[model samples]
Target: MFSEERRQEIYTIIREQKKVKVAQLAEKFSVTLETIRSDLKYLEGEGLIKRCHGGAILGKQEIKKISKFSDSFDISCLLHDLLIVRERKDRKPEGKVCVLGSFVVDIIANVDSFPKVGELINSKSNSIGPGGKGTNQAMAASFSDAKVHLITKVGEDHFSKYAYKYLQESGIDSFTIFQTEIEPTGSSISYLADKTQNNITATYLGANNTFSEQEIDISLPYVSEADVLLLQGEINIEANIKAAMFAKSVNKIIVLNVAPYSEDLKQLYATLDFITLNANQASHWADIEINDINDATQAINVISGDENKKVIIYMDELGVVYFDGRATFHIPPMPSLRVDTMAATDAFNGAFASKIAAGGTMHESVLFASAFLSAFIEQKGVTAMPVLSQVQARLKSRLEDIRPQIICNEKRCI
Candidate 1:
């Protein structure tokens, strides 16, 4: 058997038995004592077991004791404490969000700069990991304590297991994730410019484009229960439209993040509760030239069309511009060391949706998301996204530094 398969089995045994001796594992597997010891060490490193002198036990964190002073706490404080307790007891998430998108394995090569056409250059480093806007956003939402359901299609291949393992580890529900036998898993090759932190990418849609009408039917019930349904342009336009229409019929809040720009999605703009995009996407959707905050404000006004649609334009280093029909606020970017810029927008969208689902006001949610993206961009690879605690801490620490600049309608500044 393969080492990974053997290690997985051993992990299961230790989990079911609660504890197991090294000698017993060695005897059961017909392996040498040294091999069993190595397995135990590996499991321990993965935080699946706690090694003792002769055996290993399941690794579980001890629950903290609530303070006796809670009896005198206010009703709101008491309720907050109770919710925390409930989350700890059930190990289930509270905020409900459905992310309808794609999951592509990203192959990234870091280079000092882009090569000219017909030229070749050696990369500084290369890595492969979980990517695709949909998966990244779903995982980001999961990290922020949202009960995320990711509905995406992947091929039935080796790359598919990475998606399964990642979702399992992140505690996001993947039951709605579909698999295609005919097409290979979607993938992207990104060249990261080391000096400028910019990335150029090319993608193959693959199974992402294979989401069928049947899969859409299967996802309706789950999507109906969601507080928010997040859609991106990575998947087929038909699937995105179908999901949006279903969510609208059920009165679920629809948040559309327009990436890879699709002209067909323009028809659904009126139905969207919130629309998030970068400058290029906004320019395309609004049919105007957008280069700065002033240009973005004008473009958003044109696209919003006096409706209640909220528009968020992510302005890279200049921060984000938020228009809630009445007011346009400019939120400054949080301070962070520059790293990979691959997942910044996904982090923002996921964190924003997570905060909104958790009952935060629009302004508060944006602030929280900004903090999350700041922290996320400081790290590299798929693990760049931070947990809720980290985001909250960053928000608290940088509260004064990253305050939003109210451009107009000063009455509603958050």
Candidate 2:
């Protein structure tokens, strides 16, 4: 169809349906999502339609919302979220997530390759910033406009100063940071191997080790207010157990990212609402080598140990495979010129937790988190994670890419 004819049809459809999804329009026209987006862009420019999160609306109210929210924050992202929420009010979760985790200051350097025994390599670039499973996840949740309270311990030192600075600059407006005088804040040295874009990090979790059960008790007030509790393996085991038990008692949605996996956490596996880990971690825990979708599905079931646990495994080139208790869904990896992947998992977990907390079904949150991660791998550092608008811009394209890859029903995955 010609551009003018397609736009007319899209206008008519919007008038009829009130709101039209980009994917549906692209499918109906037998065109690319970007093409439909362009048509919508032209129509929106003509003041005939308003573009929402993943679709277009047929009213001026979206424009009013844009003007109201534009004065603060990134207007495009917040406006997009508002329009979507208004369009689907029932899906809006509590909009709050509480993360129980750790904080770390990273000293990262870029080099040609791993240094040989007793050899020194010239560093290409280096940076110091705040990072940790907990810190990165909290920032990612905040990026999605989820109110996040990161409960972690830091040392009374200059690095602690950087911790607060990094979170503030990264758009985290809330914190439950605690300081310890006994040990300095956690620190790590990461080497980014430039040739392959791989990374190796060695960390000393300083004050984070000092977080006790008492500290977990102190954080209960914040945890009680959240719809989701996001946990990671970076902190002490006792703290994680205590936090998990409390969140379970409160009947909150509990999610765990088993990075740097620990066998000690097996105790909490049966009770978790969602579990995210890479293929290697799943393999180690489930005692299975993940080769394909079938292998991944088996690994998920073994690790989950029961049908009630939802599991997600991140495969390097094959993308993500998720088991929603009974069935498995495999989503193809988003194509990108990946420069650094160090923070991809962190960003994914954070975005995933926020989405799941917002009442997003398993596949919906997986797609959303993967969209956030696709934009994330193109850059370096956790701080370089994309805003909601960038992620939203990719959502339609992602749906297009993911539809063919989603193999449902009795274990058709890969």
Candidate 3:
């Protein structure tokens, strides 16, 4: 991929000469004609240049060579466009993702029993981990090889710095993060009981609750620049609504996950490109009685009126049901152990949105998301997300592994 600087350089030469030969560009850039040809093709697609016989000329819509520093906004726009073109141009940045929601420090512990008045329960162990809906989803998108940016607020303390550092190392771009003065960072305290069900969670909103309209306005450029913007309901209801509206204003696809359901979800649903929620959350958001997949489908159908908005009802083991317009389908969950249900929905949306940005259709996106979540749930924590290749490989292998079983079942029918 040609650097935006280099692309600007080529544009400069083309502007000065009005016409330039491929060999000359190759010489000036100290590269091969093939490389110059590739660059010219990119510029041409951008409506920047016209390739002539053995040479190229400025296109009908001429662009002045703008300075890198002077045209910062324009340059940023070009860089973003170039990023998209580069993905299509050759191999490019995997897509840009914006994750808006909770950034929490998860404190996991194993305890004997609930402490009675003066009685104490022995604490087996404790570990501090970064776990938040926004960060987790951003991580999943990154693991799937997308260029993700997390738009979250955290305290101006050690936890915030640590969160920023963690995200930076994981390939999430740090430029899009928002840091505010303390009001402590958000957190969750979980305690496991025996080896079965657990008693967990008292979360601190901290700076997460302070996400203001001003901050959201400032973050709009990133949102608008992104191919997809994922919204989590961890922030203020007004903020979520504004962010969804902002995304819609810019024509960026919005994927809203109404987890931890809220009273204002109906207002939110009409703005989303896709809405993902577990059976419980879906049932609650749609305000209908949903006991099974069929009921869930009917509920979604009623709420998603005119088929204008798409809905993805996540039915745990039964899989995910998708309805957009007249089309309705379900992608069944893969057979895998469910160790931790936390972040599973985030994994689904992250992978699903990433796939869509990577040029996958609705069906492909949902299936890929379902496959990723199945593998994700089988693992324990945040780092459990599989790569795009790994998910695809697992999907392929699973199919092959089941071929024999399919044949046996078919034989029984025969």
What number of clashing residue pairs does each candidate have, in the order they appear? 0, 0, 0
Least well predicted 10-residue stretch by lDDT in candidate 3: 404-413
RMSD of each: 12.4, 17.7, 13.5
- For model 3, residues 104-172, the per-residue Cα lDDT tens digits are 998877666656789877788777888788888877776676767677777867887677555545555
lDDT of model number 3: 0.70
lDDT (tens digit, per residue) of candidate 1 on 1-414: 123434656766765788888899888656688988898887666555789989888778311211332222212222231111113233356678999998899999999999999999999999998889998898788777887878877887898767655654555644355777788889999999999999899999789998888778867887988999998999988888888998999898889999888888787786799999998899998888887888888777776665758889999988999887678888889999988788889999998998888888789889999999988988877666676778889999999987777787732332
Candidate 3 residue runs with Cα over 4 Å from true position = 1-92, 110-124, 192-200, 399-414
Can you list the residue pairs that collide in candidate 2?
A: none
Most TM-score-accurate candidate: 1
Relative to the unseen true structure, what is the C-alpha lDDT of residue 14 in candidate 2, on a scale of 0 to 100?
A: 80
Measured against the true structure, the TM-scores of the candidates, in listed sequence, are: 0.76, 0.75, 0.69
lDDT of 1: 0.79
Model 2 agreement with the true structure over 283-305: per-residue lDDT tens digits:
98899998887788778767766
> Cα lDDT for residue 27, model 3?
81
